[model samples]
Target: MWNRLFNKKSSVQRKILVSFLGLIIFPLGLFSYASMSVSKETIRKKEISSSLKTLELIADKLNIMASDLTAISNLYFANSSLYDLLKPPQGLGIYEENAKKDFLIKTMINYKYAYTWMDYNTTLFGKNGFELHTYYEGRKIGLDSIKNEPWYAEVVKANSGIVWVSDPSPKLIPTVDDDHFVSAVRILKDFESGTMLGIFLISVSESFLYKQYGNAVQDYEQVLLIDDKGIVISAPDKKMIGQAISSFGERTNKLADESGHFTTKVNKRNMLITYDSVGKTGWKIIAYTPLKELYADIGKIERLTILLFLSVLAISILVSYFIARRLSIPIQRLFTSMKKVEMGNLSERSDVTGEDEIGELARKFNRMVSRIEDLRDRVSAEQEMKRKTEFRALQSQINTHFLYNTLASIRSMLMIDPPEKVDAIIVALVRLLKKTLTEKGEFIPIAEEMDNLRNYIRIQEARQHEHLRVVFEVDEQIMHLKTLKLLLQPIVENAIFHGIEPKPTPGTVLIQGELSDNKVWFRIRDDGVGYSGFPPSDTELDITELVLEQSAGMGLRNIRDRIRLHYGAGGELSVISRSEGGTDVVLSIPAIMDPEELKL
Candidate 1:
């Protein structure tokens, strides 16, 4: 059922389907990954914190043990019997070597301490050097090396206070890797001054440390011991107990604090190592938890989370199929209407049936299409009107293209005749063509338009021996004002064809323009028969304004139309005439024409 509703039958609907599916799949997958990562990290942190705490507790016990050893050493150093023996025994203090050894061994056995120390009573050392005693248990005094042994020299140097190491050592005791060990040494003190007189030593087995730690395993995760030099004195890795550790790149000493966790490699195993040091001894207790084990349980939780996420996503996909199909029904209808609009049917529109955002978009889309169709119709009508105007203008257009061909034909006519009249026609045509076709622009300076009038005079001279004469007039700015192409040419043509051509004698024709009151006034005047083969004036042009205006429009109608299209109605025209004498016409057009509007 789901597959049939949201199939690949249409790509647009399929995109909607895929969008809904992503809403389920991607977020669930991301949440699963995040939850798993947090779970794994939390577990690792708990393990490391627990291990550091265990190490701190072990260090606390070591502090107590070291204190007790100090107290014992202090007490023995102040003992009067041992202190008096530091000088001369006086009587009982003097003794034989073998006998002295046997007596001290008995004292040790009674005390049951690991070992005891004593220096020779010099006054009592009558015949031999200083005597030494190495005693254990109650009376087991064995061979002594007072002169060469390191422990014997250390006690004498310490002279008074206690010195004990809370560390693991394999030197004198038999024990497994986990067994803990320590030692103590001190100097005998004078009974009166409490000054050191001799030295004593003791070595305790790991049994004392074992009892201290009894069930420390569960209380804390790990425990270790570090000495004054930052060496690992007590640790699970037995080999590292004696070997020193250097910082990777530090120039100075690197020591663990009171308690904290750090990474270190021991026995080629990278571990989370936590340690705390015994205050006075400088020895530390260290514990390590393998990061791999801590992460192991967390990994299982992560896998389960991912599985749950996949199951949820699978169910969500099933639900989304229906939701996507329901949502896409309206969008499918919108696309159908849009296709109809694309195929030359602008009247087609979407039927929006809801007030949701998507429905609003469809309604707006339909309105936009309606507006576009309206604009297209308006543009089509405007183009049709413009085509008629251009065609009519082109029918009467005799300017640049017309003159070029006429002059080229006239040049050929000159070659065949070789007469003065032909030569004059050739010269007149050359001047005429230049004046009409300007290199600068379609709108030329009045000076250039006047140049065309001179050519017209020359052509008439050759054709009818100067039947008419002309004059020009203008202002400085008006001379440069842009006017339409061949504006004067047609005015001159009308005067010659209707006015001067029928005259019995020569006549006057004038062409000129002037700037006045921010506008330009152009005039063409002639003394001739006016209209319809009559005298100088006629009723066919009875309204001077009508003849001048219409002729101005016909002569400059395109120009006025182009100007009105470009500028406005303020562009005007006028005409004046008498039946026999002449006619005058003027164009009141914009003088300050925009150069951009004047571009060809």
Candidate 2:
């Protein structure tokens, strides 16, 4: 059933419609759906991963800040002046004691200058009952007040090392107005005696943490920093700080992993939360986005997909319809014309106006039939011309009787006187007659043709008592080249008879031959009565009629016809009157050398 519907005999319009819908539209629709689904999922996953990476980077910055504070605290504890101030006085004067206090104060001030993050630093000497603080004029702090502080006690209990204390509310140094600080405290010990010297505290502002990590949270709908105890240490909302993590919902529990994302409810709104842990600090950075906002573009993409599919479907249908008609109409016309041509109607033609392969085929077919018709007419014309030429040749044979009459005259002269001049004349006439009668071939060597020309000129000069002066200017290089026989004799004859015979004085006839480019040329010029009827050099003349009528030379006309027949268009003959009251005939033909003649 499918084959019947899709067979080649089916209408092209139906075939095109079915093919476009099945092969193009179907696959395009399937691919668009699959790509939309994959693109949505890929974009969502990539966005989640990018948010997690940003959180991890913020965590790294926090870890670095903690390490910096720890290093600064350790440096301050190892100062020798702190140990000296803690040691027993050893009978020193109050002046020296004050000097040492001044040195310790200068050292702490230098620490504050070097570490910009350090908001305030203080030291308590247990033995000397003196306290030093970075703020305040006296640089003194009451030891009793901090001695009972939990962080202070924790540092002393540790005794031999540093302790980090996350203080929600730190007591401000006497004149320092900051109430929130993250403190690193360490117990100072005498290096030689292992005696407890003092307690050192370095407090960093909590605002510095927010300032460093704030940009990471800017892109999220909401962000929070939660400690291991599930307390919100920092948030975009300052009031949210110090609140229980449960206020944000159970999503905080999922943040126990190093980094992750999950869909959950936050304040009764759908949210996607991504979180990353902040190293060993027991803190995690969390970012959240509302689901509706995150996938807002997906809805637009779905709408666009449907619109694009419909646009493509409509365009494909139109294109398919036009393309089917464009191709089928020309083909149908060609097939119809071919049927006509098959029935022996060669005049039938297909429309070849379109610019396509089918149009080209139609043009080629028309050209083929035109060429066949041309060949048939040309063959018929050639047969008719051949018959006419044979008839002319037969009529031209009547001139041979003149040769017989000349032979008879030569016989009579031989009987009357056997003079050397007469014998030479008879010998020249015999050679000319032998060549004209015996040689039936159309082509001969240029050297042989020149010999014949010399013989004919000799006989003519003898008859005219040497009144005609014959000059030969032949290039030996082209003497062996073959050309149409009797080509030059006729031109030479016209030069002597019509050109020189009418002149009162002795006239010189020049026969010159040369090879140039790929052609052999001969020019016969005579100082005789110039023929004014000669055509211009560039004009194409039918030499048969031109020579026979105006030049009154049958030999010239016959030579022209033979040259044209043998060499086609390449052979040419032209006659023009020379400015010096003479005539010049130029003959040109392709140079074909005989190999056997070359050896001779």
Q: Whole-model Cα lDDT per candidate?
A: 0.58, 0.72
TM-score of each: 0.45, 0.43
- Model 2 over residues 296-396: C-alpha lDDT tens digits? 78778878888999999889878887877776787778878888878767788887577878889999989987877688679869976894575358325
> After best superposition, candidate 1 residue 282: deviation in angstroms?
2.1
Q: What is the TM-score of candidate 2?
A: 0.43
* Leading candidate by lDDT: 2
Model 1 RMSD, rounded to 1 decimal: 16.4
For each candidate in turn, give its C-alpha RMSD to the true structure in angstroms: 16.4, 19.1
Task: Please give the lDDT score for candidate 2.
Answer: 0.72
Task: Write one digit per residue (lDDT tens) for candidate 1, span 1-600.
Answer: 556656777566576767777677778778777887787678768876766665567677767666655655554445444433445445243455345555544543444343233211111111122334332123312223232444445545665545654332232232122244556755555556655444455544454454455466543244445566655455544655555544322111334456666665555655666656678666655565565555667768767777787788778777776776778878878888889888868898899678998799899989988998998899878865784466345424756434554565466656665587687787788777665654454455566676776786666545544677777666667766766556567666666656776888887777777788877787888877654433443432334435535443354455545546544676665555664466666667666555465223
Residue 331 of model 2, lDDT score: 77
